[model samples]
Target: MTGNAFTAVIDDTMTAPNIGEPEEDMFRLARHLGLDIQGFHTFGDAAEFPQLQREAWDAARTALDRGLPVFAKELDLGNETSLIYAYDADGYYTHSWHGGKGHEGSDAVIPWTELGRNYCPCSSCRARASSGDRPSDGVYTGDPGYGGFVSLHWASAAEPSDARRALGAALDFALSFSRRGAYGWGGRTFYSGPAAYGKWIGLLRSNAIQSFYMGYFIDLFHESRLYAYRFLLEASEHFDGRPGDELRTAAEHYGVIAKNFQSLNKLFPWMQPHAPIDDPDRRREAVELLTGIRQLEEEGWGLLERLLTWVR
Candidate 1:
């Protein structure tokens, strides 16, 4: 029989889109994990909330009954994804990044009514019900690749023009949000790219940002720099002679930036937006670290520009 609940490790990349839209990464992760996604659904307004709640409840119960967990979004929390693992007469048990009450990774109770009020339509998954067998453990362990190295390999094998185009696309993606402005989906504003970084830096300098948001930015840029380093490394392999040497040097610089981001993340251990950073000394230290990071990123942009001239 299915137990009271099931919980699995949530991949941060799956829940947080450090780059691109959240759902883009979510769907990519689901597919990479071989999940048979039943697609996402939404419910709004008080009248529709009850009906949607019933549908969601039934969906959660059905999946849990079969020993599978469901993905839920917008649970009065940061629009991040949460896993619904079990349900009973009163409410559902969930695990999320902010698992309510500073209890990330632990089960948190949410009354059905409360869930209904804050719920947005989300994807649900199941095992091989047709075969009456549970899904493979590998389902939860699918490889997402080593920093997109697979794409790098494919780009390398293509023509030089093709590789140049790929690099151009990568550069465009890197600079997508360097300037500040409102960006979002369906008219809901969400900070993104360099703008997101700028906003966080502004808040941090003013001592108005929470520790959680600080941690979030640290994780975001850490991952971003890591990916940038990997892409540059792979791009370096495609060139030859002087150009190749230059690319390798640029890759090395990005690697340093990536390591710096890792160090920055260590400064803030918690991941709560409302968690305070009241010490003036600590705030100054954070500002200095961010300034250094921005400087390194500017250097990276300059290096990339030089590389593009050679490739084009």
Candidate 2:
């Protein structure tokens, strides 16, 4: 855990005329990172023949041996909007390409197999799903856990019979996607949409108490490693009314999590983009805040392990 500056070096250098072999590049990168490269076997392009699969496996093993998780991050301020769009633009299940012809069932963020069945069509889902219409090319995969190809159709009034129908439809869609796993994996990728600026504000405003409670409750369960249901129960406890002991208890537990995650700011910074301090005087402050957040995430895991006993 090197804070926010996580980097992974892959073998990108090529050799043709005395440049050297691919393993040489790998060794160079490892050495550049100050890592000792003893007993390192260079992986080359030996998968061009009949046993191509074996070559790929060997290459994959080489990657794993280096212990990389492919973590990535952007270090620019103005790039936020572009990055968001670029991420969201990928794949076919997103709102960008819901109804495009020939691109059916392309979203792979969600488990297409169990999408409709386990899809949580709560406010979060609706808000994100309604961001944009399906794309012309049908390449935008929707949210995770929800396949991109499924049509958006929910009855306003709940009908007892409709429950069964919805379940059946979800299951059928999940099965269809499961059958096409290979295609979806290679051809499709998914990204979550930006939060509903206004709706999110309104929800946060209208139910600040409960919302905060739920947020904290979730953090508590996460911190303590308690049953995740504890957070849900606490959230449900405060949802109908304002906040009370239950919610407060949840918040207290979450406070511990917050103390741990305060550096990283939120459990998921991707959920909201924090404003960067632009003033020269505040620049250091901003950097410190961001750095602190990275520290929280790095150190919080250990705290989580220790706090597991407090979990529900």
Note the Cα lDDT for every prediction shown.
0.52, 0.27
If candidate 1 were superposed on the true structure by all CA atoms, what would the RMSD be? 13.8
Taking all chains together, each candidate's TM-score versus the true structure is 0.51, 0.21
Model 2 worst lDDT run, 10 consecutive residues: 72-81
Number of the top-ranking candidate, with TM-score as the measure: 1
> Can you give the lDDT of residue 196 in candidate 2?
14
Model 2 TM-score relative to the real fold: 0.21
The candidate scoring highest on lDDT is 1
* Model 2, global lDDT: 0.27
- Candidate 1: the clashing residue pairs are 41-121, 212-272, 212-273
The root-mean-square deviation over C-alpha atoms between each candidate and the true structure, in angstroms, is 13.8, 21.6
Model 1 lDDT tens row, 109-189: 567655423322221112232444322111112121211000000000112235655455445433443432345442234
